[model samples]
Target: MKTYYIKNALRVLLGLFMTVAGIGHLTFQREEFLAQVPRWLPTDPAFMDFVVLSSGIVEITLGLLMIILVKHQAKVGLALAVFYILIFPGNISQYVNEIDAFGLDTDRKRLIRLFFQPVLILWALWSTGGWKYFLSKVKK
Candidate 1:
């Protein structure tokens, strides 16, 4: 029961963070954020715009759903962890393609930050119970 409380608290905090970030993308014209989109992506600019908008909505919605669906919270959390991992390439690409987008002037700092992506991924995984599933899967 104590462990469950800790997990719930962590999930709630993560969900709130995601919700705020999603809303931030929608309410603010973050050219820096969108500019990181790889040029090779084939979608038209308008379509990409909608995609960003929709991604934000989806993140926000999933955050809320994870909070309300206590019985399935772990499943939802695992899904969210996967989502974070999936999006990491973009974060890496952004840092690699242009450090300026992140308002950083030094490649050294940027590279250092890149190393922390896995930490964030792990945190998401821990929050979502992915680590538990991962261990079980590994033991099988």
Candidate 2:
């Protein structure tokens, strides 16, 4: 069916996006990206390393899960949405602390990234059937 193909297409697109992002985070220890986290953030070097590795692994896993497995796809999508929400505070901290340690030079660019945060969240929710699931639960 057309609908089925569309759904798969959307999932694949999202998966590819995440996969590439994770890979970048893993491979590019770019100073620009590292500068975003301030020195006073109480982030231990080991912990930060673990975070980087785990985040990449999680992203890769989720992409594979969404693309390779046919069943429980919606649940996997929901989990990915939750993961996006969980990482939101990091984005907030960057904005609130004015940590331009990242290459973002202007407040405008930081604010723009903040806007993008929710868009990604909403996209994940919609892509994963969270909205439909919520509606079904509400109807019941």
The TM-score values for the models, in the order shown, are 0.78, 0.78
Q: What is the C-alpha lDDT of each candidate?
A: 0.70, 0.69
TM-score of 2: 0.78
Off by over 4 Å in 1: 1-3, 134-140
**Whole-model lDDT for model 2 versus the true structure?**
0.69
Collision pairs in model 2: 35-101
| Model 2 poorest ten-residue lDDT run | 30-39
* Deviation in Å, model 2, residue 114 alpha carbon: 1.1
Deviation (Å) of 76 in candidate 1 = 1.0
What is model 1's C-alpha RMSD? 2.7
How would you encode candidate 1's per-residue C-alpha lDDT over 16-105 as one tens digit per residue?
A: 877876786576745555754555565587866766677688778867866787777667777787777766666666667664665655
